[model samples]
Target chain A: MSEDHVPGFNTLSIHAGAQPDPTTGARATPIYQTTSFVFEDVDHAASLFGLQAFGNIYTRIGNPTCAVLEERVAALEGGTAALAVASGHAAQLIVMHTLLQPGDEFIAGTQLYGGSINQFNHAFKKFDWHVAWADSTDVSSFEKAVTPKTKAIFIESVANPGGVVVDIEGIAQVARRAGVPLIVDNTLASPYLCRPFEHGADIVVHSATKFLGGHGNSIGGVIVDGGTFNWMREGRYPTLSEPCESYQGMVLGETFGNFAFAIACRVLGLRDLGAALSPFNAFLLVTGIETLSLRMDRHCANAVAVAEFLSSHPKVAWVSYSGLPGDRYHALQQKYCPKGGGAVFTFGVKGGYDAGVKVVSNVQLFSHLANIGDTRSLIIHPASTTHRQLSDQQKTSAGAGPDVIRVSIGIEDKEDIIADLDQALASA
Target chain B: MNHDSYPDAYIREILDSCRVIAMVGASANTVRPSYFVLKYMLEKGYRVIPVNPGQAGKDILGQRVYASLSDIPEPIDMVDIFRASEAADGIVDEALALEPRPKVIWMQLSVRNDEAAAKAEAAGLKVVMNRCPKIEYGRLSGEIAWAGVNRRTVSSKRPVLSGGGFQRLGLGKGRTSN
Candidate 1:
């Protein structure tokens, strides 16, 4: 469809990246399960490999089915281009690989997903890439953390599990002053909740494994390049400004113009890292994305009711859902996620640790799982699970308390969700 | 003892035996309460499992990290929590689904959820609320040596009579002690 015919979110979700099969008239995106595609001729094959042309060469680098997903996600996120990857972690790795080299550094929020924290803290250390951790709640912290080596400032649009919302505009201003790009992980607050690009984020990433898949069936990730960051003006990014040795010394910035960084990620990063998304998973994710607006609406509405229910319950000691008026992040939520804060939130049981366990053990409707962003309700005790690797101090900083429980409200009937919670709390 | 009033003995035994907890939110930062409580639990020998999703698949307190209670893939007698009440429902739901449901569900100080508690109780799960497991364990295990003395000597001695009782005592006379 043309820009003038761009449809609404729901409509675009279902039809943006695909149409009926050109040959067989199949409605769904077909999984090009094969590993390689035949080229039109020797010149075409050479051009594909030389970046002179665009076509699928191998599944390891790209695939026709996955391409649809990338296009749709890029369109949905309002980005110039996107690259689908194996996982959210892989997406970060690929983005960093394309943006940073050994000895380069990046500034990131302290309140990021714990796995990302570990990746930046330990795994990235081997690559000699340093991360300056800053408090997402404080823009000044980010400013202080930025150094000459900083290539990007990263933060989650809404922090994971903790449900803390970052001020994208404020951070973007900081990044602009530092002459670096702002990379926002819009995983928790998917585009449906808040579009980070609209708020000045230069790049957006998602663990399409979560809400993007919605069904908990697929594991995938994507990076959406806003095409706003000027790589040529910045002498710092040699990867983009200089000629790439692997691509016959092609200057990505000069060749790709608006989409240099994204193209670099696809041709260089994914090629080396081998983190390309599978066509099958891409199809599943696209299916989930089709109902994105609808599911998010229900997820947010149910979460609001659940947050309110927990806030008022006698058995609830505290509630940290931004949807609640008294929550510290409520104002930010109103400013950012005006429709409602994303479904995930935390609360403490009145009777302490024992009660916390009891409540978790009693719920019948809610699934006790580690993953979030599912259509079904999911729960976990961070102190005993996802954050167990962190010390008490680290856990506290991450907002995972010993008596705290995390819930990802699903798109189920709000009354039923509340009822299960009611009974569980009573038993607790 | 009122059998209905006091927690079951088996539950008490289970609570007593557990040591060396991995509390996911065991905040090492002193400002966070979980820090002190985790330290206290560690001192008490209860292996506190620290399970923060953000920090998952790592090591805390020299113990390998697990992403969720189910992910532990080992015998965890109890799962202590310091999360919000809304989150309790899902945690409780997960706890019950365990192969051998946890012995106890302890909500930390200032945390509670009646429905979760009731559901756990119905599922034959022991539940405690508005109380930290570390504090309770210390108190019940005699680790808080002065707790009894403080309760008896300090609290019991302070007799603030209710309005109805004060009237019955006829305090208006300002009677001297004979």
Candidate 2:
């Protein structure tokens, strides 16, 4: 409350959404492991149901521990509010459910996580929500692809595996012109590296399992409402604007103000979908965020060194990392994420698929895994594992070619990472 | 919402994309925040028109002052509200009534109105309540540092890349032909 003092990033990371427990004086946020909360009286219960006041009624809809994690991530991202969900994919489902009705269309960037590509291409078809793919590199493509039914535009702040930084501002403009909100998946570039809200994003999502959880110990995801989009605009998003019959005809946007979208996702999406994040996972994620700034700084530093090493290596065909001076997305990185281009990037092996497979099987320090943003180095041959089911064209479009080997640089000493990769490359 | 600070990136994006800004509650007095905000926006290459009933038929910052948003002849991309929070409703209503309604409704610092904001948003207009465009633009554009004051964050120059066959993901560029 001091007028002169403004909390810095480190301070906010530690104390933004938490205070000493009033009842027990616990400094750290305690995991309220119960399924429900006892109401003060019938009036208190009714007020909570009516959205007259903010209180925990059920763990599935809301929880104290998860609320702290939500507030912490929201503050970190400068978002109006946040909701923690079961996994990254669950977060996407909640967001899409809130935005799309049957037959509504949304634009998505081609360069995205393979799982997301699969989700958008196949699973969403069943729901009757169509996806129109656009090139993230060309901002105009988004405009060209827009139809009257387009409800949103989605892209990754820093794409997975390939470490390509997107033009969030450019696409946001297209979304703005089309009367749609821009959603950016900030899984790779956490708020420490890039805050999508600052770049005109209306909504931001994260796979807390990766960087925010930091240790690969938990599976979690979050949706942050930038509170920039107008969901009530001409009734495009009826779930938020129209009166909800489920809740006695309450209009969420009118009642919640700037945070309507987040409220809708929680009360409707999570409540019905039943993909709520456990309180235990929320506690772990909150703990992980305490050291996010420190870990991300080291991750970027190590990644830059590793990228430089790979780009110059004789056996490496090409390296894709925006932190590299000559990389294609360097300009985007500088403009969007000046801190660094993030820790994960991909490089091609000279011997193609066989060499790529050999490198992943050989690395000692870098664990061969399907995940990124771990505290310890991790590597995977996407073409052989994650993107294996896709066709050659789909693999290429997603930046997972047969020769590509992705590396997620950790906080390890840069020399050890490079030496491990060098040994793996020599073996290949 | 906190009136003191906002996400800097959002502010800069709005400033960059918007060309014509209609300054509501514009004043001819040089010392007022509205006058300076209008002046600073003009200096930043935005086509700012002054909207003040009292200043009609007069010039502020060398641009003719219009009585209200309806009086402006050109399309307005942004409507910067410099009046008190109480006056926001009428201004927003007027903004919404325009033939080609403005895309954004920006309330100045210390001016916050949830009702007006919700109304504008329902009509498909972006709203920034309790914030100032001039201060945000100066802060994010790195021009405020010239006054010898340091904000926690400052803008950095965009990266100049060494380009030749550099493509994202090394997997061809642009969309594939249908």
Candidate 3:
């Protein structure tokens, strides 16, 4: 309880948003399995509904269990507040729903998870939200994409599968000039590796289904409000700046101030979207986060070793892990995620498409799957699986060329992981 | 001192030392943030006198309302400016003219005036801007953790709550020895 004592990352990971249960004094955060909370009386009910008080009413709006998860992620990201939802996709949906109006636009890095690319390109169009693609490796691409209609700029802290560390500060400047918020997807590099807020990002989004829920057991996503962006500056974002008819002319940006974006996401988007995370999944994710530092350390170590092995292998054409000193993004990795490159990266098999598929199918220890950031190593031949629908030109542009292979290195002993990949490569 | 950041000791000291607060622009509307902030301060055993020209002489959370700082008869320990940044200058000027002048001038969240802050600081009054004392109190006392927000500080010490109506924690325990 020293006056200036700030919690270490490991401490905040475990205890930031948690205390013992008040009613039962439960040491572990018990799952509040019920859907709704009972009000003490009519006055209390009125207060809760009117946003006059802070308490739980319905699980769809806010659950006690999910609130803990949201708080912990927000704390880790150095954000003022956070909101948790059913999946990473749901997290993205709620975020866009809050920021964008009909026919508005957001700029996203071209190198992204295929799922997000799809979400922005196809699903978001239904809401009349357009996605303008930019090259994260080149910050000027983001600058060129800026227009009056651009509501926000989005980038991945570390691009998925491509394994490039983005220059968050450079793009943040573009966002600043454009009068928009820079949203960084820190799913690849958890808070242990990189905190987006510290690098001028106005908001940080995470697909907690991956690294944040390290075991790959639960599906969840979180949005962390950096509390940096002034949502009222231009009145571009009416959801925050304007008065809400639903809540008696209360202006969220004026009332909530720094944490208004998070409040709006919860009270408006999630309330209507009905994407509430199950309490059990939140509990599991919470437990997963407690060991984040430990798991991430091993994840980074195993990934670097595996990348080194692949780079030297006879059948490997190239390895794209920034942890490698000679890799293109090595310097950027050091600048942003000095700890390590992270668990996910990509490489090229010498024999092209057939070899890539063979390597994935031949692995014993590595699970051939679409997911990453699991305790178990996962391998995917994207050209054959996820990118099959796209043309070869599209696949290459998306960083899923014919010879490309993606792997999410697990926290298992490095030698064991290398040994598994070695045999798999030999068979291929 | 940097207006963007404050040391924990600075914020903790201000919240702990100040007992009576005069909240300018406090509203009786339940949904407004100022209303809840006033309620929370009262619940935590801090006496908050509401100040609003419109709501003057009315009872807000059972505390007497005053039209202005000069009108209040009691010695104010702190003036919590819940008004906008443009209005902070006049509020600080009024606070500076008080007899046995308040020790602190605290601006609420997103309300900051550098000129007004400099004036207060020059007069030997501590100033904190763009921060909510309720959030700080909850953070320092580990009460924010109950709602799953990061208190930012780590502590193993259990909070000692006074025997009272609501179990609100205060930063007064360890500071008393100081």
* Predicted model with the maximum lDDT: 3
Chain A TM-score across all models, in listed order: 0.97, 0.98, 0.99
On residues B1-178, what C-alpha lDDT tens digit does candidate 2 reach at each position? 2334555445555676789999999888653557657766775568999999998989997999999899999899999998989999999999999989898899987688889988998898878987667656543432322111123341112211111311101101121201
Clashing pairs in 3: none
Q: Calculate DockQ per candidate and list them.
A: 0.00, 0.02, 0.32
Arrange candidates by DockQ, descending. Answer: 3, 2, 1
Whole-model Cα lDDT per candidate?
0.75, 0.82, 0.86
CA deviation > 4 Å runs, candidate 3: B1-4, B7-19, B28-31, B42-47, B57-64, B73-76, B86-90, B96-103, B113-126, B141-148, B157-178
In candidate 2, what are the lDDT values of residues A143-177, reduced to their tens digit? 99999999999999999867789999899899999
What value does the TM-score of chain B take for model 3?
Answer: 0.93
- CAPRI verdict on model 3? acceptable
Answer with 1 or 3, whichever has the higher TM-score.
3
Model 1 chain A: which ten-residue window has the lowest total lDDT? A1-10
- The residue-by-residue lDDT of candidate 3 on A194-238, one tens digit each, is 998999999898989898999989999898888888988778999
Residue-by-residue lDDT tens digits, candidate 1, A271-351? 898997888998899889989989999999999999989888999988988888888998999998887799998998887
Interface RMS for model 3 = 4.1
* Residue pairs clashing, model 2: A198-B9
Off by over 4 Å in 1: A1-3, B1-178
> What is the overall TM-score of model 3 with all chains considered together?
0.91
TM-score (chain B) for candidate 1 is 0.69
Chain A of model 2 scored by TM-score:
0.98
